[model samples]
Target: MMKNWLAAGAIALTAGMTTTVAQAQSTMIPGENVGLATGAPLPEGIYAINTFIYRSQDTAAADTAINIPILVWATPFVPFGGRIEFVVAPPTVFTFSRVAGGRDTSINVGTFVGGLWAFDLGGNVGVSFLFGSYLNELNAGRGGGLNILASNTYRAGAAISYTGDGYNLTANLTYQFYDTPGRFDGPNGIPAFFGPVGISDALNIDLTATKKFGKFEIGAVGYGTVNLDPNILVFPAGLGVAPGRLGRGGRFALGGLIGYDFGPFSVQAYVARDVVTTGPRGVESTDGFFRIVAPLYTPAAAPAPMPAPLVRKY
Candidate 1:
């Protein structure tokens, strides 16, 4: 029963995690999947997960606003009785900066595709693992787009869930694989002498613990991101350092979540603010997030045969 209940939150975390934080772009957006069991295996069906997220800026200069439309298909080809899932996401990015009078431009950053394998470990516990890639992403400040990273990044993530007695506890994390020797993803890649102009490796962790009361659910959620490498801002060749870097930078935030399930669909929302910032606190904005998870296509129910006509002969 508990494992069945956790399915409501088995919402997988997709790539396209393009958002600005601590003055850097991350491979996976932090704190976007709070209060959900992102580690559990979803049932067989085509599903959609839409997320609206923003970083609040007082002046709206170089603010972060994103809308991600993620499509997931949980395939019926259960391997070893586990679920296999595939995902695709095409995200929209908005520029809300006031250079002269600010502009609201929606830019096509790129697309994200990945696959997942989830296993049910019995005892209301499940584990999900995934590997995905972010493709066609232009280098930051290049290709007339808003992306900050010039190198296409790859990510490996996992989610572990434990549900019991109407409780949902999950830990999810993603590690990014990338290197910015020179502007890599931009058209006509920039020379390495331009200096290392992008971010180094990093990791994101989101933790959730919540309990359901009938149809209402409430919990406390926390998220943190850390840069495994600890360089610093991009500098010119005079300094002999990369053009820029955000190594050794980390941020952590905590917030609350309240959501309700409407049988066929479910919704969850949460707000978290930076509690600890390790490196530079360039933009410490309070973040707001709203998410919707629902099945987009389900197998049609088998129809019952028409009863034999009146039996008039009898």
Candidate 2:
């Protein structure tokens, strides 16, 4: 009789879990295109909008993960051609596996860092530094979501682009270093299952191109990453099966973007698909997704004309 009662209660709890989330196998898409416009200096002002969804995984498996991030940013340009950018994103909700898989399937919910800076070098080239950190507390599981909310992550890279004659091309290369292995422990403080066994530094390369056609623009962008440490690729974290092991070597993705520029404010929608994988034995994922970013730039006054060019000097 007691067993029957407990099973009935579990059924009721499972049925109610649907209210927490919609589907378990959610698609992994790209983040919205924030500032793909001319890439030129804009008037100092604040920009806010729905940055779009970042689909990290999309497998037919019973479990899946998805992230919905909202961004608010402020850009201030100094007279010396330098720019200060401040940004913050809240929630960054992440759900692992499926709701049907039960509450035990869920892990943590927290905020992530999405801020960076651009120091101009006259033309369309600039050296930029970026810093991103994850702050998530283990809500229902062990390991406290260590990787989701450990110390902050910092990355520095250089970028160059040409925005001339209604054409734009940009390329960037960055290296990522982690402060910790982002591990997790069980209730007794022993290591957990999903936590990182070992982690090594990595490198990334990104490229993008766009062409303007009146008010509408079309283009594509892609990125690839390289794994530096072999141990990090083949230790206890190895995907169990030999095929899944190669999935750690590296990865690449590409997609299309469409935009409409209207004066100071422009709206851009992007649809990118993962075409290839850099992994060895085909243990990687090839899930494709979509994203959108509408940046509303504030209006600025025209620069003052050079007054009577140095008449006294002559």
Candidate 3:
């Protein structure tokens, strides 16, 4: 009788502890490709699709860049189960001209991203690695339709995440590299690097936080980067192909997302604005980036009960 009472007391203690853990809230980052810690019970054979799009307008000659990225994720609900996330974006299409009549006048297309892999580290801490490449440039001539960057590149990164009590926090480091310099094909004799390739191997560190209250969730992100190999903002469309003339490259963004989750599915809209920019031209509109994410898939349905109910009312 004493052992039974002791066991019952321990069970109550554990339940109280878990309840306390659930009462503390958290936040998540905004963006499709980036990992947002999911604090729910991991479901087996779960598949989800996400779409992210961002458009930034800058005062630079290239003026604007629109990025449309899609992602597909699959996870099996084992204790140490794994998850895979990847982007399915076509090349980005845009125009650039340093001078009004310099005449590189043509549309250009950049490459798409490959798949990325993530492994759950238990307790809401997930780690991920990239298994993909980005094109250097693509042909955007008369017959061109969404060409990729020719100087394809590769990337890898690591992240630590924690999700509990309606709150989520994530810190990550990403390394991106391209083998070639100022090598890209553009429209009508226009050089691929006409604008900012923003390339040249760099390490990016980012932090994100999110909190959920009832049906509404809100969050913010902080990002920083260090150029391992500093080179001029390579623009294939330039005349002298000058290096070191371009301004420094570093940036900070402040953004938030407000959304509601219904059962196993949810939808969110977000806006991120650059508070500080390290582009060659200081705070040029050409580099002002903003993105929106939408749902690409609905979750699975609840399972049906067995033939008989577990408990009889009689």
Candidate 4:
């Protein structure tokens, strides 16, 4: 049947594209910490963060390199009782053994303006909503696969968290609308099989559960993405490829995180592996990452009142 053929083609196309864009486009977003919700905005303050991501794979000869340094500032409250935040992340990437060319490194930047609304329901439960966009930044090169900067896109999401005596649970869902970045149209280029393929919208989800032990917290994190549209439509009107395909670009991963809090600063380390595939198949990636966050400026904590001097009854 025609449907079966389209499904087959979609899988093949996704496999090919995976090697090309694996690094530049990912299920994870910058400024988002493992086991943390993207929709949960930070308290009013300026913050600086460094995220180092190291990834390894079996199929390709080269590994992926990603380093992101970011600065975020959030306002106390906005007109609608929500917080407005801005983020700037400059990421450096290195792609190994690329197909279009060879190996290369590129530096890119991602900027976002977002609003977050968080409300407490009851019993230590809270929910949040986030809406933002990644404005014009450098798109990934055709061959390189280790880019961490998001392609030009808009995203919105919501999150919910529940805290108990010594444990916490958090989950979030987000949707992305990608802008069409034209494909390389040349001999042995991507356009031959599918001309100017337009990317479908995607949905991303993450969940985390942690148990707190004084200043140290340990948690498990899981995340994945699914393309909403079933097919990659051909653009520019000349490619022979049809519009129907299975769109098997979905991917899932699981990881663990350990974090330590230091009053005004925090550090977290995480390790993750692809659950569905190894290599040359579904999304193949094994990544270890760490993040450091510190407050740039914040109001000093109110000092405790002097203990009432014991009254001498005599």
Candidate 5:
């Protein structure tokens, strides 16, 4: 039940506690795939997991909130001698700024869907690969002014893990490609200091090393993220505005996680800060995360113990 719980995928940026003028340039948010043995394969069953990833991006920049619910199913049949799992997650986004007495707004976002294939390579080592898309429905007339979530993103990634001796060492890598870098759901797109802006491609990697002792678990976790291309100003596709070189910047964070298993349910939590910052102001803030994984259904064991009764020799 403690095997590869969740893999890697890109969603959006963080809405920290402070207020600043920071618009997300990269699509992949760091620390989204921390804790858990995210690379290993789960046994054949159906499970539900809620992992909250908070970002303190750009220290007092405006803040956003998101609630994402995920459902996963490990299929009974294996393809190419590997386990195949399917996932679907849709998130509700809430954006609010702490200026002018705090303005609040809400909008419809995308649903994340992924198809992952995981394999166990003996020695309790597992590897998996996945492909997915974030189909964002950021239509107009929703409201105005918010650059917190990236729309129309495609993601691909891989994960590997070694779960042995009640310990887990795992890492997951996700690369996100954004189609509309300077686009949004509101009538106003990308609240820029000047004009519209865009971020090209980005990559994120999450690492975890943990050991379990009895019902308690402890681990160290971290993540590093970078934009693959230069940040630039954007315009409509039809409007031919040749993009120019802007700049490249990224961030790195480190933290720790602890968890406790009670019967068939487990909960984990962690907090991390941007230990290294190289981009916008207020990008140096702390993020705390919490997660819960529980089983919703399970396949019946084979052969059972004879549904009726066994005859005894009298």
Candidate 6:
């Protein structure tokens, strides 16, 4: 029964931690394909689809997560210029966890919806503002305590990007505010055994730098997250679980990416290592991700050619 308890405790901790991690996972911008200005709106009447397949191994807990998220980007027929865009991502997750000498698995679904406004600052520079939220009510495996979705949370952020002759740079910053869900019930659906839990607000940052090479681009990506209140409370915490095991501290990752553009379509692959972990109890994961992006609209018109150079008269 020790194995059962280990699985149960792991599940309980996962439930509390999923809120922040899920929100961050849903907000990922597919920058490997589009670059760092993920918040930039598409042109009017343009639509694009992004599909991601991610696999992560959590070494600390001996757990593995396979996540697939699909996002749709669209610019509706608004009176304003194509400066406004909407995004919706629906994510499905599967996790394989080792419990004592055996393993258990669970599946869940989550949703994120948001909008962004992009503005061209001229000189190959652009900026965007975004607002969005994650809704965790649709998950089905929470009772198992191994779900990968989080509760309700709101997010807002901004991104800035620059494009030069052969390189691109981008940075994005965001803040997430979490809501109190009161407590979590374990596999037995008993709160008295599993105990109450809470989540703290978090701040996150993402940075990318890529160099263009004909149709291919190579880049480095880095991201980090820190809880706003490091001393947040997790009830019944002395049960051998770490104090910040429920998403209360800082986590960071760094990776590299390669992408190729095929006219209106693009594909990118990336691998990342969790450099700074949240502690021995928190997850230390190595992640691999693949993304496909395609635009479902005709290409925009090219600018008119410049007038021919004047010939000197003798």
The TM-score leader among the candidates is 1
- Could you tell which candidate, 2 or 4, scores higher by lDDT? 4
Tens digit of per-residue lDDT, candidate 4, span 1-314: 11111111100000001222322233234214444434334556676677677766756666665666766666666545545655555455555554556655443434444545655465756566666655534444232222212246566777776665655577777777656553544322222333343555666666777777877878898866666765544233454433344344566679898877776666778788778631123446777778766767755777999999888876
For model 6, what is the error of residue 251's alpha carbon versus the real structure, in angstroms, after optimal superposition? 1.7
Best by lDDT: 1
Instruction: Give per-model CA RMSD.
Output: 5.7, 13.5, 13.0, 10.7, 5.7, 10.6
lDDT of candidate 4 at residue 145, scale 0 to 100: 22
Clashes of each: 10, 5, 29, 2, 10, 0
Q: Put down candidate 2 lDDT per residue, 1-314, tens digits, no spaces.
A: 11111111100000000000111100111222212421233334544434333343344233333333344343655535655455554433333434354442433343444444545565544444445543332233222333323333344444555555555566655555555555543221211334343444556665668777876777886755555554443223433434223234555667776766565445556555556544443223332323333344545777988788555754
Q: Estimate each model's TM-score.
A: 0.81, 0.63, 0.61, 0.71, 0.79, 0.73
TM-score of 2: 0.63
Worst 10 residues of 1 by lDDT: 184-193
lDDT of each: 0.68, 0.40, 0.40, 0.52, 0.61, 0.50
**Considering only N, C-alpha and C atoms within 3 Å, which residue pairs clash in candidate 4?**
23-145, 23-147
* Lowest summed lDDT window (length 10), candidate 5: 10-19
Per-residue C-alpha lDDT of model 1 across residues 145-256, encoded as one tens digit per residue = 3224445678788889887777789998888876443342322321122432445677889899988888888998999877776764444354344344565777788988
For model 1, how many clashes? 10
For candidate 4, the 10 contiguous residues with the lowest summed lDDT are: 7-16
Full candidate order by TM-score, most accurate first:
1, 5, 6, 4, 2, 3
Write one digit per residue (lDDT tens) for candidate 6, span 1-314. 11111111100001112322322222232222224345344444444444343445454333444343434344454334436666665554445545576554544444667777666566756666677776665543242342223356577777766665656677777776755443455422211224354556667777777777877878888877766655445534643555444344556778898877676566667777778756224556666666555545535778999999999999
> What are the runs in model 4 whose C-alpha is more than 4 Å off?
1-33, 37-41, 78-81, 96-104, 137-151, 187-195, 233-246, 277-281, 301-314
Instruction: Give the local distance difference test score of model 6.
Output: 0.50
Candidate 5, lDDT over the whole model: 0.61
Better of 1 and 4 by lDDT: 1
